[model samples]
Target chain A: MSEPESDSISKGKDGLTIHTVSKDRLLEFMKDMKERGFNHLSLITGVDRRDYVEVVYHLHAMDRDEYVVVKTTTDNGVVPSMTSLWNSARWDEREQYDLMGIKFEGHENLKRIFLPENWVGHPLRKDYDLSNVQYINMDEDGEDYATFDQGDGW
Target chain B: MNNFVELNFGPQHPSTHGVLRLRAKLDGEIVRELEPIIGYLHRNAEKLCELTFYADNLIFFDRMDYVASMLMESGYLEAAEKILNIPPPERVLWIRVIMNELSRIASHLVWAGAFGLDLGMLTPFFYCFAQRDYILDVFTEVCGSRQETNYMSVGGVYQDLTPEMIEHIDAFLQSFPKKLEEIYRLFVKNDIFISRNKGIGVLSKETAIDYGVTGPMLRASGVNYDVRKANPYLVYDKVDFDVPISQKGDNLARFLVRFEEMRQSVRIIKQAITKIPDGPFFNPKAKKSMMIRLRGDGEYYARTESPKGEFGVYIVGDGGVKPYRVRVRSPSFKNLSVLPVLAKDQMISDLISISGTIDLVFGEVDR
Candidate 1:
């Protein structure tokens, strides 16, 4: 984790190191990082790059103060879930899937978190439809569901 | 018939602070499992930050952790300033330290009062609020608003502390600790409080680290990682303060850790107020309009010791007035993730005791 041994890793001027891993290697790289004492999975987020979504991981070493970013882009919106290495990734990955529409391959509950399960396209995508109006209402089971029909309105 | 009864704790209950909903499975009076269902207050905050100008984004954070608005503003500003690469003068840094410490105390005071209410002790809530009123007065004098104090700006604070404001803070500092001592004697030493909180909902150190718990929750579990002590952003390294920790990893341990933290915050403020120098508050180069149209092309993650765990702002700037992407690493979100593990096999009444110590603030949790 100290020296950037491969071309995927680059250090920023502000001492922030960003390592780009392929989607297939994310879980393996994360397992190695956790073993090396980068046990804190600080954050997991995604950015819409128009053609693909780039997933970012902010990892921290608890014993020492080393913060590093591990990134991988997914054109098909699929990345191996790292819940095996750190359970903290569960909710964070759910958030990314909810907002940026990234798919975590092995996530047990890979469902929308913030928005309802029946909502339209992911809202954080760059070209997400803003003009389309949707509504939320409670069902007989007392669960909130999303709908597009005007009858679901107030 | 089902062996376990299904119950919904809240999206609107007094004990469960600010709109958090938990689905719990109960067998008789024991909680078998609990799943926290959040997003009752999710208002698309992160998405809005992307659309907002750098100048206007600070206020948006005010509503996130409203009880500790100053700390939230400071957390975001710490990241924004790093991206801008324009550190304010020496006086402003000290000012930030003082205000941040006071904010921490104020935030903890609110928690103390609410915790008392959760335990059905009404008198301590009033005493805690009375002490908190004094802290809010100082914030109102320094900034214009008490709860949503948009005092912090990029590169500097909006205004300097006047002499009258300084006197008010001094008076508050001199008398507040005595009142805090009264609160400690009333609650911490009370046999009933101990019986209610002791050894309830134990979260092991391994589980805490696995869930990325930070702030008092992490410290209470014996992991000593305070952003101030570890990273020393601002004048933290210059000022001397202790990071209080507990090894018990239980509800009472979290309570004791936070109580000790408030005392340490007082220590930090007392030193910062004396050491603060006279200088221009803002960096002259960072103008209002210039900040609005700022096109800083870089990314930085600023972690601040917020009242809640490791509150962070991860900013990605792309040569534009608005940030390309902004994500908040909210501590409550992570802290709440540990509920099922902790609440397993606990009594139903202990739910209040456990969540009270977990210190759920749904504004941050849902945002």
Candidate 2:
């Protein structure tokens, strides 16, 4: 895929530029940023938009004093991962996978990061069924997350 | 290079600090490679954020970095306010600062205790706990919870502090410095302490920045970057305190940063307590209809310099009762990235010392 013009990108609130990149040019863009000294990939978080997936990479440039939020869209079935470029992306991808059912394609090791390995559905998805979900004991008081009904059922 | 042996450090071990295990590849006494295995204490904090309303999310935020829960609560509230376009009142901001600094002191006390225990010193841990117990009493009086205060909310703090609570804080603030001095006098110049920590686990400035290290760990590497001062969240811009930095970039440098940071935190608390005005704690006039309404349909990133480092809350609000999506940029996770590289050639015994210096709370790491 051909690289889009620079004007296509928009600036984020925290001074990060939001670039819409295709899967083919994503690696090239990441490499360009790394060469420009965005050596630290601060965070990789996913958002589920029902019809599509939005993967945001919070990258920081220590030498240049800049940060950019690189975002890419994927179809519901295809959640492209950036673990190959940044090792720290591994955990974030696993977290995205565990909660939003987004698969980190090139992750060397990806599993349920914060939830049980056998959880039925992505709990963060809009259509997640809470009624049938089993409770997770989180604290010393044995607070089961499943039993506590989210009053609005959203 | 005859063989490489595998060593398993526990999910239950004392030094692991609350359900964190690492399977290390060892070549004699030197570590060949290290794989951190987490999730024993994972509570799915982000998922829980999606399931509940924003107001109720404060309680869960407290659990993220339970040792410094007040900071996490503040981060969440700050992010929520950004989305709602609401600035907390001056009194609320002062209260938030007071609670946050106290939490920092409390967290450092525990860290000092645990770090000493890991380094084979028992007395410091006891001394730290005694000091921490008194601080927890102050926390419990204000928020009704000792460890996890959950005192922060969207528009402001949960409630106004009583005069008695202010008196208690005043007394604690006065005595805390003396107790800190006593601890410092006991261990700061101790020959054995210096030998164990100084020149151990030396992380260079270049590598520290490359690994995205923050908080005391990064400050110790001579980085003057502090989110509170550099970015100035809440009322930190108005507060007068020094950002302590060390050029040594060793375990001792990290240790010294924590010590100095505690003193600075106390200084901040003193100013906030003395200057805080008698006004409405929360913006009681935040139109009743606006309580559940999320005003914006965009994303906001709210980052705060917690005791542990940069605790950030990234939220995508969709003008709904619940946040569209919530992502926590936990400092521990970022700090842990530098571990394998840091541990590449260090002796096995130095591993715990290095780990303790970084102060990775598993709750935040695994969240």
Candidate 3:
């Protein structure tokens, strides 16, 4: 297999080569990288850049001992999931959805991960209101679970 | 055929280890599908670090993998140093290796004892803890804290190791092997232990990699991918030791892999202590200021082989006192992801054994 399109690739701040693929081409780019022996998808995280949410993929090629960072930006917070390509991306994508509000298309379970189901806003977003916090009532029943209150519990 | 019962294993049980709830779908005695419900111990570590100054967040790194705080601190500090382009002196690196290896042994001791307890053997728990206390004494003598030793700083470690600290470690190392043997004979050679663990929760080499399992769990599956050996950070490459691997991919295999790893850590500590050079522990330049500000926008990921697996830190600097973004790629988080796969089709009793072998520390997992 040939390398990812040269236009999609650039050097990152740490001197590791970073591939900034479009949201649509991410799965294909990841598959190609996996085929090229970048077998380990070490980390998957999202950074809320205000203008657009940036999803970062840290892939490690164990054979050649090379590290590559693949990042893609999404304005609408919808990006194709790489869970099909890498099993480790499953929880990571869910976490991104939970904390950064970056929706992963084709994710098997795209529900809230760390936060309670009743959480209103993604906490990691740059514009996330720290003052507009909600506390869950743990004593509530399962049917009435996580009743959000405007109290300063935390 | 449609009679599948859903069993909630734990959010409070002892075997689950630290507030982990597994919703297991069972067909009679065998589990069909197991989903791990985490986040009970979540403290939003990544988000919390972003709010704190670079130096101030080092203590929180200790809380991530509380069992092996030194290794976690080392990984975070290394990432910070990478972004700042600061290299710690040779003595600091060797001292870190000694501390990190001691932490490794301590972490593995906890795992060993817990694993034995999970397998219904109580004696090994006491044996392992006794040895672990000695290692903690060494940490206390050096860093002033036993478990949460926030000893590592951005440019270097917090304090220099004293002669008394070295002597304590030396004494521990001398007595550790015999204690380890007793535990080994009790757990490894025992027929009941083998019957409980061997060939149970067999995760194939391909499956382990596919699930991104690391450290002892991956090595137990016959993979030779160790962060210490693969990507050498700190003074790990300079230290001569073998990464023990087993092809069984079963509970027994994972147990043996970690059991051998404790010995390897001892070996590394011995060599690191003997070869530790006399020099400055922390970088003199960084010591001038309590707060460190990176000059430019940069991002770097640095990983160290923690006792559990590969503990990594990815930092994004916006040329500020505090990091723009800090993402911790905790090994337990990824390692715990494989539980559903490993637990599938296994007996309900064997689930405890499988989870024990994986060595799930909920602090890192839920982070």
Error of 3 at B344 (Å): 1.2
**Residue B205's C-alpha lDDT in candidate 1?**
87
Which of the two, 2 or 3, has more DockQ?
3
| Model 3: reference contacts kept, as a fraction | 0.66
Model 1 residue runs over 4 Å out of place are: A1-7, A138-154
lDDT tens per residue, model 2, A35-70: 777777777777888888878888877555566778
Q: What is the lDDT of candidate 2?
A: 0.81
- Per-residue error (Å), model 1, residue B148: 0.5
Residue-wise C-alpha lDDT for candidate 1, range B168-285, written one tens digit per residue? 8888899988999999888977898999998887888888999988989999998898999899988999989899999999988998899999999989988888888998999876
- Weakest ten-residue segment in model 1 chain A by summed lDDT: A145-154
Candidate 3 per-residue C-alpha lDDT over B17-52 given as tens digits, one digit per residue, 9 for 90 to 100: 888899999999999999999888877888888888
Task: Give the Å shift of residue B23 in candidate 2.
Answer: 0.5
Quick one: best lDDT, which candidate? 1
Which of 2 and 3 is the better model by TM-score? 3
What is the overall TM-score of model 3 with all chains considered together? 0.96
Model 2 misplaced regions, further than 4 Å: A1-7, A11-17, A76-87, A115-122, A134-154, B285-296
Q: Candidate 1 chain B — worst ten consecutive residues by lDDT sum?
A: B288-297
Worst 10 residues of 2 chain A by lDDT: A145-154
Of 1 and 2, the candidate ahead on lDDT is 1
Give the per-residue lDDT of model 3 (tens digit) for A31-150. 888898878888988987778888889998766878889898889999998888889889888888888898889998999877778777888888876665566655545632444445
Task: Give the candidates in order of lDDT, highest first.
Answer: 1, 3, 2
Model 2: per-residue lDDT, tens digit, B1-367? Answer: 6488999999899887778788899998999899877788877788788778777788888888889998899988878877767778888888888888988999999999999888888999999999999889988888788887877777877667999999999999889899998887667778988887889888888777666677899889987878887778778888899999999999989988899999999999889888888887777645445566545457877788887788878988888878889999998877876888788888998998888887978889888
